[model samples]
Each structure stands twice: as C-alpha cells, then as structure tokens.
Target: MGLRPAHPFLRRVPHSRGLRRLRRLTRRDPVQLLKQLPEQEQRARLLELLRADLQSNEEIADETWQMPSLTADGRTADLPGFNFQTRVCDLQILQGVSGEAMENLTKTCRLLFPLDGSSWMPCTADPRCLAERLAQEVFEFHAKGFAFDPKRSGAEWWVQIRDSGHSEEGIQFHWDTDEVAVERHGVNVHPHLSTVTYLTECGAPTLILQCRNSLRPSETAQVYGSLAGGTLSWPKLWKHLAFDGQLLHGTVPKALAKRLGDLPHRFTFSAFQAMPRWSPVSCHAGRFRTRFGRRRLLHEISCRLPHRSGDTTAGTLQLHWASKDAMLGPVEKGRKREMVSAGGGEKKGCLKGEIH
Candidate 1:
C-alpha cells in the first residue's frame, strides 16, 4: 500500500491542482522558505515542508534484545555508580537491535527535521512503526518485569536527533516528575522509569545522576534537601538504556568534552516518563494512536509536559552545570517546572527537591 497523508508531515496530494501547488512549492526549495519564515510559522507542522523533503517521501527495525537485569537476567551489567542494584533495580541497557528497524525509523526524520525550523516534532508511530514496537516491547518485558509502576506509568517517548553543534548550555539536570497526573489525586508522583534506544552510535555521554526529587515531603521550611549520589557516564551505540526517571539526568553537549568529535547529528528514541494511565498527560499520547491504529503504541505520550520550563521547584528542580565536573549552581526554590537523569561518587549536582 502507498503511504497515506494522515499526518501534516505526510500529506497526500491528489488531483491536478494540489499536485501542481506542491510542485510549485517544492520548486522554490522548502529549506530556504523555512529559513526565511517567521519562527512561529517555521515551527508549525507544515505539509509543504514534509512533502517537499519527502517528495524529495515520508518515511524501521527487527531484532530485539534486553540487557541483563537482576529481575529478568538474574545478573545485570556493571556500571560503577548506576543503580543496577536498586531494590527493584533502576537501569537496563538493550542491545542486538535490528539495523533494518532503526534505518526505517530514522528515515522518518532525516529529511524533514533538519531542514524544518524546529528540532523536534510531535509524532506517533503505528504498531508496524518501529517507535511503537520499541516502547511496547520495553513495557511488556523490562518495565513490567522490573517493577515499573504500570497503573501510574505509560511511556512518554520520542525519536530525537541531536545536531553536531551540541551545546554544553543545552544540558540541564532534573527529575521526570508527573506531578500533574496526580494533581487531582492529591498526591505527588514521578515517572516510574525512563529509557533511550539509540539509532546512532554514542555522541555525548548522558549524565545519569544519583540525585532525585524526594518522594517524601520536606519536614522543615528548608525548601529542598539533597543526599548526593555518585555519577554514571558514557552510553554505547545500538544500546537501549533504561533507568529510574525520578533520578536527575543531563548530557555532556560540548563535543570537546565528549569522545565524539566533528559529527553533525546524533539520533535516539527517548522516553522521559511512562506516565499514569488515567492522567491527562497520558491522554495526550492518543493522537498518535488515533492516527496510526492499535498494533503498538507509545502509551499515547504528548511530546511536551504540562508544567512550565521555569526554575526548579519541589518536584521540578533544574540544575545548571556545564560538564559533570563543573560546579552545579544551587537551584532556586522557584515554582514547579516540568523535567526528567544518574550516578557519581563525586558530590556534584546533588539535589533532591521537596514534594510539597
């Protein structure tokens, strides 16, 4: 079957007029048009851009393997500061994924995202789509087996591409708190876990923090209290790494500070949270299911979190630091911000924000 125009990014043009209009648009060069347009307009989900680049098509994998964990594998891999030994275990890295599957998935982004004004897009993949398969498989096998809270957890995932000009300033640290899901429930919460499925080899190392927002409320008026945990660094390519989302994480963006040098872009399938099923946040994931159908899904994840991106607060604490060694400035006790990281014996970027 031919590709359908169900998404703005994958518009199906029929008829002499529509085809002619697209031909005209494509003729002028969509990339140049995107650069010239206003930021808001450029960010819009544009059929023209999608079609131009794609006409230029719209757009993965097979193999499956799960990392060894105490629950499923009887023994997990060794990472000095990683929480592989946590009560239910806190991290898992998947390997031996089918190259065919990822190639197809990356095809979905290659032409459009780089040329479009935005670095990311809100999208859903069908059961046949690799993204759906990746998320569902992880939930059924690893998450369920490792004790990820399903009632309060569903995957919030996206396929991301990192530009070569990655910045140290771009990396911010925080925990993935789903406070909004339980806002009406009257209790605070965080994503049960998180995962990253790599489409490309390692670019920059993601700093998985030892710190997290405390599930317990602050006893004193002391805003936040932190018991620093060591750090874990370095991520291998073609590996799937899953960890407790409540832990803080950020990446080493500067290529100079990282092993990767001179590469232009990096790709990965990332999940910030696996939200509660009943929350409005989970409902945001529905658009993809509605469009793509039910063979598999990302538990209906909305690309953006409901909370603000402002200062770090109780459940949402943001850390400003360059590299892991760089001193982490104290987080201001500001209003709640939405976010999601790892391990270091080095006492740095240690922050366990308050619950209320």
Candidate 2:
C-alpha cells in the first residue's frame, strides 16, 4: 500500500469540559506568579522549572576522542619561592566537537547533580579510563604522574555548575589540603596537580596566589601571605588549565558574574590527581598530620568576620576549617574547645556547652 489513513480514535483524545477548564486555569503567567514570590522563592521556582526543561531534553554525548599523547615535556619552570609550577594550556581534547554537543554535555552534568546533594557530581566517563588519560597527559607535560589508588581514592572527573548571581559569596581564597581530599577520597592523599576544563561558554578567571612561606603547619606559618598572584582565564572550548592544587587559589567573582550573566549558565569538568606518595616533595609538610600523631581530618569551623560592604560594616558569618581538632583554635581566633569522647561519657556536660 502507498499510504494508510489514521483511525479516528488514534487521531486525538477528546477532552471533557472539566479537563478543558482545568487546562485553561493552569495556563496562568508563570513569570507573573514568580514575581509575586520572594527573591529566594522566585529563584527556587525558576531553578525547578529549568531543571524540568533540561531533564526532558537531556542528551548524552556518545562520541569519544583519542586521548592526546605527550610529544614533548610541557612542564613549566616552577615559580620562584614555590615548589610547584602553575601551568595553563589550550588543548585539543574536545577537538572536532561542536558547540551544541558541548552545551548538551554541560546541561546533562548540571542535571546529574541533585540540588540537595553534594557539590560534586560524578562524570559519565569511566573513572579508570579518564584517570589514565589524564595521567599520561600530565606526565608528558609536567613530568608528574598521578598517584592512582583506586581502592581508596576518588580520583575521577567531576563537574561543578555554579549560578553566580545566586551564589552567596564567591569561593574564598583557600589552599587545598589532604584533609579535604581525604574526605572526598577515602585515602589521606591530596592532588598534586589539579586540571580544569570548561564545558560551557560561561567561565571564570581563577586567581592563583603565591605566599611568602610554604603552607605547612608551623607556629609562624600564616594561612596566606599573598606574596604574588595572578588571574588566569581561558576560552570556553577545549582549553584546559593545570595548577598546583596546594597553592592558594580562588575565583574572580566579578569576572565570573559577568560571564554567567552573559551566558546565563556556567559549568566545568575538573579532575584531581594525587601526588605520588613515594616522592619526598609530595609530602604536605605535616599539614596532613596532627600534633597528636593522628591523621588530620577535615572539620568545618565557622567564625564571625568583620564584613565591610563599601563604607558600611555589616557583620557576616565566615567559615573556616581545621585539619584536626588541635588546629581549630588557631583557625577560629584562639577559641578553646574540647573534643568530648564519642561515647556517652560526657553527654550531660556537652549539652551545657556549645560544641564549636
């Protein structure tokens, strides 16, 4: 037969009067309704609507590219007074890919991260494969090989989607510590080299700081001295930036906000490679170990900071963290606190005093 006609029943479902009325009532102006809500509520509703739209049109990239092989040593000379080199390069990692494909990947990643879950969202790529690809590239360029501990390491690619307009504060200036890394990965290991690849047009320029002293645990060691620092930004395509993770780094909020405003979206694919454990230079200089001979674990410590908004001073809460219990005092302006035993030995006394 050349063609077939559709049956009457298959053509359309007749709507009842009640269903028609319900549809009409539900078709109100979403923007007007959003305007009636508070700013926070408006944002929440908009995000929910955006998520629904993204979920319906989710597309995963099936195309794979050959991992680039290192031809010549691409490591940069270490900066003066710094143990590691901060490297930036434009790679053809996503070469032959289209703008539309990259956009889809970014949206998929953003949808993967549940709003209530951790900031990190796992990548669709095989962790081992991605790790190996990165290790080869890093070795070829920086002469640094990642310490791949699959059993106890969470060293894999991830994505971070940030809405700069809604972000309370830009990421504060901070250095990477093994304590945080261990919390992410089960092992007490920190990334020697951190790589960032932008998957969307909206991108932020990272600020890298060079301090006067090595960031080790010492009575005289300050959290940061800011001997020197510079901003690094790259195109949204296939370019990548690699840096010494231990060095203090943060984003330029103004620049990031501009990018986000221009594109209305921002996200990146990032990977962290733990330093080779056997290397003497890889040790975090006792930063990962505590005074009590216990392994330093990550602990969040919040403190009140003298926040100044232009000419006015507005008191604001700030968050600091200690690698271990003993370090909390220094992190929180000499605030003395006791670590009650995990057992019920001092339950009554603990209730009488604040824990932090």
Candidate 3:
C-alpha cells in the first residue's frame, strides 16, 4: 500500500520567531524610534533593544563568515599584505532610487545563507545598472588608465542584503578571496575588486587594521599605507565605499563586541569584479583547494599569556580557522580549548606571544 501525501493544510508551520522579530524591527523607522526616546536614554535603550531583540531571535545566531586557511606549501612568506583605502563621496549615481524604496527592498528581500552565519539574499535593485555606474566611477577614478575592463573582463554584479549580529562577535580578520566560488569549481576565478553601499547605519564602525610593513606585497601596485589601524564609519545613510579585495581586514575588537553586537542592522549592496586570470595563490588561503578533490586541512595555534597591563591572570590567544559547521568542544578553562569540525578531523598547534 502506498502512503498518502500530507495535505497542504497539514504542512508544518515555520517557527521563525527571529525572522518575525527582524521584520518588525525593520518595519519601524529607527530614526523615529530614537527621536521618541529622551536624549539621555536614547543611547542606552537603543543598544538594549537592539541586543535583546537579536539575542532573542534564535535564527539570527552569530557565526563567523570566513576562517583563515593555511597554504599547501606551508610557507606564509607570500601572504598578501593589508592595504585598505577608502573613498567618501556622494553616491549620485545610485540616487535614482528613493531611500524609502531602498529600505523597503532591503526589508522584503529573501535571505540566503552566506555559507557564514551572516545570511544574505539578492536585492531587488537592478544589478546591471549598478555595475555600469560603478565601472564608470572606477574608470573616472583612474583617469581611464585602469587596465582592467569591467565589461570585457566579465565582471559579475550582485546586490545582496546582509544581516549580521553580535553573535558574529565581529568577524575574524580575513580577506574576501571569493573562496566560496573558487572552492566550488576549484578554479581561480575570484573577485579582485569589491564595493559596499551602505543602506542603513545600524552597527559599530568597521575596524580596519593595516598589515605590517614587513608583510607588504612585493609585486604589483598597492594603495594606502602600512599604518597600524583605522576605523571606517557610515555616518550617513546610502553612503558608498569601495576598496581593493586583497586586504587583511576585520571587525571591531573583542572588548567592544558585546556593546555593538546588535546595535547595527547592517544592510549593504555589494558588487564584485573578477580578475582576468586565476592565480594559484589566494589572499587568505595560501593555495586554492578544490572541493571533492582532497580533504582541506586547517591548522590552529592557541596559547595563553598575561594581559599587557601586567596582570598575572592569563588570557588565551586563539589562532584558528572559523568554521560554519564545526562543533566546539568543551571549555577546559575560561576559553574554548578545542574545536572539532563536522568532518571529525582533529589537529592542534601552539604559539606563545605577548598579549597587548
């Protein structure tokens, strides 16, 4: 006897309390809410509600977007240096759409897993129109001297709605090597240029650290300097920022992660331009690995050291790949001592360093 199919009315209901809360949060104008609160309580309440709502939602759990990978050759000498450059200007090109329209687009769009905890979905905005304008701006910035052809190079365009939370604890410092695509095909096609258009101002400022001068790239041209660190803020809504993809950048420090966890409801539209040829070396991972070819191995180094302020109590220093599917092992002490990936492989290393 064949089993009968379940009726449509008998289908399981989606219990996404987090998604519902998110919808409610976005539906109301944050500016009006802030205005309604007294000045003294505004800051505290804003932070509180943002954090509480996000924390309450089980669907919006924090997860790292990318983890650092080791090179196949085991030589870290060729690693790409950190060079972050920012340009602030009016995004007149994208002014065609009204702010309300953009906000609505961000709110109603579907959310897809970014392979990281940061869920993302495509935007309703026209990808081709945005790409064309961005390409024109890039050309104007270089005075027609830019070698890469946006159209001829087969640049891929996308408008994604990204939602990240305090659970992310600020993404670990990493680069956007377009590793997701490369791993799928095991090919070198990756984004060389990345542009971010801020749709809303809801999170902590992104902290960009400069790679040490000793680690600067040996070949090719580099922009920005080898400074220690800098913070990028989105003071106004609808501001656009573009930067080279080959940079070692991360979010705020661990100290401020708690306070900024849910304060910012980051909504952004991003575009990625691909390179003409694939390079064997990746900015984040030392060498590219193809999916289904071999098991990709990651090395994690952890150590404990006293605080830089001369405190005797030891603080753990963790250097490991951030996994999307890894189940963390129990904490032997105050820190997570070990992590086991979904694949069941285990490896460990140690490194001692002064914590400042």
Q: Deviation in angstroms for 320 in model 3?
A: 26
Task: Give each model a TM-score.
Answer: 0.42, 0.39, 0.37
Candidate lDDT (C-alpha), each: 0.33, 0.31, 0.30
lDDT tens per residue, model 3, 247-289: 3433332233322223233433333222121111211222111
Off-target runs (Cα >4 Å) in candidate 2 are 1-83, 115-154, 180-189, 212-220, 255-356
lDDT of 1 by residue, 177-284 (tens): 332322333322443445555455445444454454444322112213332332323333444555565555544443333322222233333333221112223222
Ranking by lDDT: 1, 2, 3
Candidate 1: count of backbone clashes, pairs at least 3 residues apart or interchain: 21
Best by lDDT: 1
C-alpha lDDT (0 to 100) for residue 150 of candidate 2 = 27
Candidate 3 residue pairs in backbone clash: 62-167, 202-264, 203-264
Cα lDDT tens digits, model 2, 108-173, are: 344333321111112122322222233234333433243322222222333455443333223333
How much does candidate 2 score in TM-score?
0.39
Give the lowest summed-lDDT range of ten residues in model 2: 1-10
Compare the candidates by TM-score and give the number of the best one.
1
lDDT of 1: 0.33
Off by over 4 Å in 3: 1-84, 107-145, 150-165, 180-192, 212-227, 253-356
